[model samples]
Target chain A: MSQALLTVIGEDRPGIVAAVTQALFTADCSIGDASMMRLGGYFTIMQVIDYPRDLGSVEMALDPAIKRLNLRVHLDPISSVALTADMPNTRVTVYGADHPGIVAGVTGALAAIGFNVIDLESESSGSAERPLYVMVIQGYAPEGVESVRKAVVPLREREGVEIGVHPIEAAVF
Target chain B: MAVLSILTYPDPRLQRKAEPVSVFDDDLHHFIDDLTETMYAGPGGVGIAAPQVDRPQRIVIVDVRPKLGEDCHGLMVLINPELAAWEGMAVGREGCMSVPDFTGNVIRAERIQVQAQDASGRERSYECEGFEARAIQHEMDHLDGFLFLDRLVSRKIDLFRRKQYQK
Candidate 1:
């Protein structure tokens, strides 16, 4: 078993990550995977750090750091299910006049079909004269399926927009 | 007739800058045929470039016609196409076969007009907007030895890996 999941969120500034990492280091915690991003005024950090498997030592390992950093920490035992199996790359693209429900409709459709939305990014700009809304979503197509063709027909019709799906580049290591 | 193997990244051949297709001859036609076959042979690809199939020549084949709806039929265009004009801005998360295993944020033009020749040897120019335009520009960059990796602006952070090579 790996360590607990560690998430820290606060204002963005120099040494926030360093301060948190320094605390983890002193406690001898191993980081599994992590990501930090900033939106407008807030900086957020999410990490999966591994600790000894013993449940007894879990709180002992994490409490000191949580107290020292003054950052909120959520600790959950890492399970085998946390490790997602590699799946084939699948892509979803949506385009329409910039409007609401574009994302909800598309993402809702994907969820209905059992598609996992691994990553998504969207941007909309330009005036009403030439408004453009574009989104790219990457996912994994279910195994044993030869195609996702016709899967997005309802999405296209309901959203009144263009929706495209194709298998993403399969990276053979 | 040859169905050349589509080279994934790190093959070294994919990194070469293709020479301009000055020969509008039989060899060029053959190259186009191979590129078409290669594009269709992949899982589901809408475009292919000369460099992708190990031939470093200024040629690209794009067929968004298949992706078009019943109201619109996509065209399988052969472009020696030069981008003539562009406007607006777009940020997208894109991935490529050359840079397999990763996807990144890429910023590109929203609309463009490209002047070029079709598959039939007659000269034609395409005024592309939206997805078609983006794909055209993306594939055209291959002729100059550019991959989508060069356009990446950021990573998903959590998705980042220690060793990210196109192997």
Candidate 2:
């Protein structure tokens, strides 16, 4: 079996997953690491699957998802990715009245300082008139956590958002 | 006392509820000592449960000073521990020796009061907050056959690769 990246998007519905997965099952493909969720009424899936056949077989297997769900799909043949030793050890949470450039300015500053973002989850919790954007990022920042705490200070002040950087505590044993 | 081997995830023994200790004698004291030794022997170990070492009994050892700094109770050996009361809530990341590969977000009470017996069968109670409370709840979960993965935040696959960032 080999690995391939498959992405799918369509109007949110219950059968979207069942349809796609059933097709893959029939094609002798099994999913590995996957992220499937609904974003603003549009359902999306980004996953790596271990397939028994070639990329064309995957496209053929996804025919049901396209025709039945009226979805757009893309299948890419990608080799298994090499993982870096680095994993996210810090948790950065940003929240403020929704505005443009919040993601850009904040992430840019952290990136310039060599922060590798591992997992990020963001959402707007308030109304459109008073939008509140909140994002939590997990990353590796080897340049010192104090510098990480300071990296987004300017952006926090300028955008009137709260940006907190702290090491993620892992409770072992 | 010897450092017993820890049981990793998917071990059916870990899912069984640990029996409550009815006797706290010399055997119990020695078991607690071995548990303490095992907790310190594991990489980044700070808390452990008896079932983790194939001892299906309500016992746990914890010392969070290494993780939470000086604000924690140095070393606690809780037998048949139970959460007496709890208040507030917070989400924190946790990794377990049993669940070796994945770490995930768990939402637990911020402040907690616990009642349990010591090795000598002496009753004791503890009041703690923050990471200390979280650690106790985590260990107690083992007594009830639950891991952090069972109480994940929002239940949206919050699990992540457990990584070591110690420099």
Candidate 3:
């Protein structure tokens, strides 16, 4: 079996997933992991699938379904890699008035200290005249948590954003 | 005391509702010992429910004293525990041993009153606030076959990867 990354993007509408997934089903491909959501009136899908046959055949099979849904699809054959079960130990949240380089400024500080970002989500809300940007990041810091926290202090001051770094403790119950 | 194996998710047994403790005998005592050992053996383990170990009984052990120090009520062994009253609300992140690989935000009562029996079969009642209250609520949910995933405020936003973050 081979692994393939599939991405689908099109105007938000019903039946987009049904059509795309139905095509994969018909091609005898099994979805391993998938995420589908709508962002700014556009529906997007990112999925990893396992196919018994070659990548070209899978693309050929999905072409008709893509055309019928009026969607853009990208398919790439990717090497399968072993996934680790390590969990993130820290959570960083930054939110404040919208700015030009908040993401770069914050993430750059994190990267400098060898902190790996495991997940991040950012959104701009409120009215256009007074926009608010919020970014939540979950990651691991091998260089010690205090060092990472101190490094981002400058970004917080310059960007005038509220920043908090908390230890992620998941109590077993 | 022995540390029993913890049952992980996708196990049909984890979904089954635990039975109430009708007889508080020596067997029940031993079971609680093993359960306590198992809970402490887990990484950052603070509590354990009987059902998690595949014993369908209404028993749970918790000790937030280690985490909260003198601020906590120490180790508590609640048998047939039930919530009597609760007040306030707070959202906290929780992860379960039975349901590994993910964590989620859960809104629980900030303060709670519970009634239950001790290991000696003596009736007891206690009021717990803050983190202790949250842990009790979480463990009690297991007795009714409810995982933290069921109480998540929102699946799309509340659920998060346990160790890694991916878009």
Candidate with the greatest DockQ versus the true structure: 2
Question: Model 3 segments beyond 4 Å from truth?
Answer: A84-87, B1-8, B19-30, B37-45, B65-71, B84-95, B100-113, B121-131, B152-156, B159-167
Strongest candidate by TM-score: 2
Residue-level lDDT of model 2, residues B100-138, one tens digit each, is 878887877888899999888899999988888888889
Q: What's the DockQ for every one of the candidates? A: 0.06, 0.47, 0.47
Which ten-residue region of model 2 chain A has the weakest summed lDDT?
A80-89
B-chain TM-scores per prediction: 0.81, 0.90, 0.90
- Which docking band does candidate 3 fall into? acceptable
> In model 2, what is the error at residue B65, expressed in angstroms?
3.5
Separately for all candidates shown, the number of backbone clashes (residues 3 or more apart, or on different chains) is 4, 0, 4
Q: What pairs collide in candidate 3?
A: A87-B163, A88-B163, A118-B165, A119-B165
The weakest ten consecutive residues by lDDT in model 1 chain A span A164-173
lDDT of 3 by residue, A23-92 (tens): 8998899998888888888999999999989888888888887888889999889988877635677778
Tell me the TM-score of model 3: 0.81
lDDT of 1 by residue, A78-118 (tens): 56465666554676777788777888877776666677777
* Candidates 1 and 2, the one with greater TM-score: 2
